[model samples]
Target chain A: MVEVQALSKSYVGRTVLDGVSLSAPQGAIFGVIGPRGAGKTTLLKILATLVAPTAGDAFVAGASVVSEPLRVRRQVGYLPNDFGVYPDQTCAEYVEFFAACYGVPARERAALAADLLQLVDLYHRKDTPADRLTPAMRYRLGIARVLAHDPRVLLLDELTAGLDPRARVEARELLKELSSMGKTILLTAPNLAEVQDLCTHAAILHAGQITQAGPFDEVLATTPPYRTIAVKFLGDVRLAMNLIKAANGVVDVQPFNEPASPSDALAGVTLLKELRVTFDGAYADASVLLRSLMHSGVQVVSFAEEN
Target chain B: MRAPHLKLPALELSPIFAKEMAGRMRSARAYMVLTVYLAIVSGLSVLLYMVSFLGSPRTVSGSGAVGTVVFYFLVGMQVLLASFVAPAFTAGAISLERENKTFDVLRVTLLTPAQIVWAKLISALGFTLLLLFATLPLFSLAFLLGGVEPRELIIALCVVFASALMYALLALYISARSRTTVGATLSTYAIVLGVVIGIPLAALIGSSTVSLALAPTSGSSSPLADLFDTLLTLAISLSPISAIAASQRFFSATGELWTFTPSFTGSGLALTLPSPFLILTGVYLIASVILYMLTVRRVARIEQQ
Candidate 1:
């Protein structure tokens, strides 16, 4: 439930965001992926109503950012990429403080803070000082703090920037759960792979402009059609190479070498050779190719597509 | 037809106020400051009592003089303490939010800019009032000796409170305009010192110059002389210390709450002036409102930065 129409923001003579437009449907996880300094954070800030656009306007939950910023603020919760916590406040107090700021009745604030902390998996640390928590926990606290007001739209800037792999996966799952609960989420990431599986809709922002925006698959479709399939195997490298070359939709095959992974070595398997095969085909066709290779009696170690 | 129903907005305590107060009061620093302030005032009160009364023969008139000395000393210490600590309380109110990157998060909330500014201001002032009120017993020492009137004591406390308020608001305004806590604090103290020291210094020089210039026309009524007198009164009122001293002088001279100025030359216009305490209080209240509005505007414009 967010619409940005030709939003442009500039400072001095330099443009930070230029004519950027995108729409996020209600309950959809929309991701704006870009490299550092590509204006993803700037775009989200405009939607969050923390920064005014130099030109044009954005609407969050039907309120214009320019004309009705207070109304927009009421409907949107923003989590900045980097923020500090009140060191003296307990985690629950931090959340409750924001709850009060949102005008939640004082009597209900304690219960609400508890529920929000539980949602973010931080209930155990409710009484801990916010600044004393680990970075990941602090990030979760930020999430809970944003949810205190139960806004209709959430603008999360670089949601997984500094998270560990496990925490990143958990954050992705949380975003999915939030989407299922009918919350409109607009998150940013430094790369597409970070949000590829999680975002229902995605946009590629590069140099203050949107190069691509749409359904996740549709955006991927706009890219080059060639896909690289990596195959690792144990025995008869030549045979596996031959099989890969014979597969349907195989455009090219290149043999490569790498030491076996610790897991493979620990399993007492050795002499693994990897091959990179460029293939163009549908999902079913790829599956058939895999089955034919297996039927040909090549001991396949692993087969996966490389983004 | 029935008149339309008018709904007054409900009063709600600001979350910022609640949060700031809880954090500030819970910290050891608040109590440490309170303890040290009371200790100093207490020690000084005892020292002053001994020096003024016990150092020589005890008499009714002597006790009264001792009480007056003790009372003025305590009040002077209160004003000095407030001037020093009030700015420290608020100099980081907004700038620290910016440094910590919480400004945007707070701004995105439903609280209005005015709410944020006023909440911060009131929270700081609340702590300052606590520091002032903590010394009530020390003030009662002067009262028990029977020299200081209740009205005088109350008016003196008002002057101290108003000065603290002015200091706090000035710091908050500077905090809203500054990008860093250090910068805001330094700027606030600089301006506070200038007002405290420079204004009276400038008034002293100006009045002297005016007197010398009007020496030839001393016996006659000149508008320049009257204007200079008005300016002198205002200048003295602006400085809290001078205002306190002037208020005491006014009280002892008239034994009235307020009085008008009579012309130095009877032939000239008789200018009506409120007592220095009233003038100081009025100026502080008005300046506080203006500073509050400016701070609110500055906060509202933070998005542009």
Candidate 2:
């Protein structure tokens, strides 16, 4: 378990982490989302015992980061955004050194190193030096290095950033597997869609503070009531715009920039519109408007939900 | 059952010392230092043999071979190598870690600051000593020439070893405090050179004035020169190069580290003893330890966000 009690940090005169508090229970994947420069990294570093908070306390597995950093380090594994790995050391040599630093016995180091390499799927690249490893492979190596000690808590910062789509998907799968093994995972990411898909619980960070937090469903429910829907229309955009403007449920109508509302590309017609409905849990409101549009003989080619 | 959780001890971690030493030992720089040391030793040996083979066998009054050219050559090598190589071995020890960005990895480990510092100091110079010991055959072979004594060889090695320790500590201390290897390397060189060259020269220049003021009746140059030279040499000897100058003070017939006096007019000259290099080297050793400990403290508490 990890608890951050009103944690705060500052560099020079500028505050980074304002009095923020959070707790991650055993076996939970807690994702933190924020835009650039929102202090996600600072909070994670403090929890890792890499930096001290200007004020407040962070405890990892019941060990205070400030007072018992060694104990804290032993329990929490931190993977920084850049994932600094020593350039010259090969993957196996790198893990071996960390295992030694972690004071895993000399006899057990090779086995542990092999296990971590296999876990990260870098067993094939074990002989390659860190500088030669691809960014995605480096990220895997970073994860493996952290887990070499078998820590209870993982403070992962932007694990999927800089990775290609396929790599990101694979990384997400690995995280889910680690989370299932009873590891309390604290993840930070910039991709909101990825956050929504992967996070069981998440907090939206803004301007050095968590603006909204909880399980995905709870956070979504508490966030401003806004719903978006997409529609493909069988006519020029003028016809779709007029139909959306006259609709009972839709509050905002915007044209979608696809299958351009030109007569040339239309089977009969081709246009798409994105509609935002300002309704608080009213499914009938949207259904009523769709019925009214269809009754007007404006053929709705396709419809779907969106952000 | 599990033996323990998080039982890693701060003192037990190797940090990067072993790797650094291993890497350094394999570098051309290590071989260069060894080569230079060996060249000085052998070149000096050959030069002395050439001079002795041609020149008349000399004596310091009644004591035969006490002030032989052979004795001075062996002692010269010990001092020259200590002054030249000790700083080279240590100056980049910790700063290289900073330049390479590996200091943070070592710092975040369970290893305490002092342990890291100790490990660095030891590993930086340990390989150099191993290389130095490899030349034992060459140094031992110097004994076959017969002018050198077993005790003198022992004392020379002791002085050389002691000087190396002092130089290593001083250089390591500088490496720890500085942000770059260049800074540590340059500062150590400057400081070592100052001790080796600056102190004796300054004292030599100042001694005449000091002597004239202290005793107007004495026109004796040796009194001023010897007095100031001994004191200046005391400081110089504090460096590893002290082994250089003290190497000249090989065993006399009386088994003393003393030299016979120059005959003063009318009165008998007193035997002047070379200042004990070990005592000065001891002071340097103590200072080096204190500096190393200070470095360990600073290294341990470093944290970056």
Among these predictions, the greatest DockQ belongs to 1
When summed lDDT is taken over every stretch of 10 residues in candidate 1 chain B, the lowest stretch is B1-10
DockQ for the candidates, in order: 0.20, 0.14
Cα lDDT, model 1, residue A135 = 73
lDDT of 2 at A202: 76
**Best candidate according to lDDT:** 1
Screening candidate 2 with a backbone cut-off below 3 angstroms (N, C-alpha, C), the clashing residue pairs are: B79-B244
Candidate 1 residue-wise lDDT, B84-136, digit = tens: 78888899999999898888899888888998999999899899889888998
lDDT per residue as tens, model 2, A1-307: 8888888887887888888887778888888766457888888878877778888998889999889998988887778776466665789878877777777776777778788888889999998987799778888888887787788888898768677657888888888888887789998865345566677787877667878877877876676554566676565566666766666645445443433346645644433443333322367767776776677776776666666
Instruction: State the lDDT of candidate 1 residue by residue for A61-172, as single tens digits.
Output: 8899999987887778899989989887999999988888888777778888888888889999999999899777888999888888788888999887666557778888
